[model samples]
Target: MRQGLGTQLRHLIDLLDGAVSAAYDEAGIDYRPRYTPVMRALEGGQPHTVSQIAEAAGITQPAATQTVALMIKEGLLESSPGVRDARQKVVRLSARGRDLLPQLHLCWQATRAAADSLDGDLPYPLSEALAAAIAALQHQPFGARIRKARAAITKETS
Candidate 1:
């Protein structure tokens, strides 16, 4: 049986993520790829709310919230009541997170170089393909495509 598009895409992501994680392990860096976006957002030295972090990280608010909670538990981030709005909370990198930045930066540089090499070896660069796919999805989302297919199926059945 042939692999589905979603399965193939997920496998590729897992492979890439595993490679990066292995590199981090070899370098003795305790970090996860998923943490990168949130860390990068806080790297600017600005305290931001969950919504702000989600926007900056290009992730959903719930995801940001969950990541923040985990980071807080891991001592990588700290949160405080929002200055203006007491009900809201703002988050920033903790001392431990700041200490890890230098190593992370070096790892990031190496990872970028490795990715560039991979892109060069491939028939088409994965980054460009991903960007194009995302752009296409923005114009016509998968949900809409599924709905159209479903409507066609219903019409045929009727």
Candidate 2:
């Protein structure tokens, strides 16, 4: 038995994320790679709801909510009731998060350069391949394929 694509992808992500995490540690920045998306989404200095953050960050609503809660606990983010919706909490960067942006931006640039180098070393760029896969999935989702395969299997068994 060989590892499946999902497992392989997770391994690759762990490797890349570990490298970035080490770099952040070296710089003495208390940040996680998971925080980047939310930080970038709030960079424009506007408070946004968790749903809005999820959309802007290209992540799930639950993931955004969890990240926001963690950031809040870390003193990097603050939240308040949404103006339009009392039940919705709007999130914004705290002073600590704002102060860390300059360092974070430098780290981001360096990380991009490193990723480019890695991509250059590979036979095919991982980022490009991932983008292509995502595009293909958007055109024909995996769920639909799974359903079709199940139907074929049922017909064969019948």
**Highest lDDT against the true fold, candidate:** 2
Query: Which regions of candidate 2 deviate over 4 angstroms?
Result: 153-158
Residue 129's lDDT within candidate 1 is 91
Which residue pairs collide, candidate 2? none
Per-model RMSD to reference: 1.4, 1.4
lDDT of 2 by residue, 1-158 (tens): 99998899999999999999999999999899999999999988999999999999999999999999999999999999988888989999999999999999999999999989988999999789989999999999999989999999999999
What is the C-alpha local distance difference test score of each model? 0.93, 0.95
Give the per-residue lDDT digits (tens) of candidate 1, residues 99-157.
Answer: 99999999889989999999999999988998999999999999999999999999999
Q: Model 2, poorest ten-residue lDDT window?
A: 81-90
Candidate 2: residue 130 Cα off by (Å): 0.5
Provide backbone clash counts, one per model.
0, 0
Deviation (Å) of 35 in candidate 2: 0.3
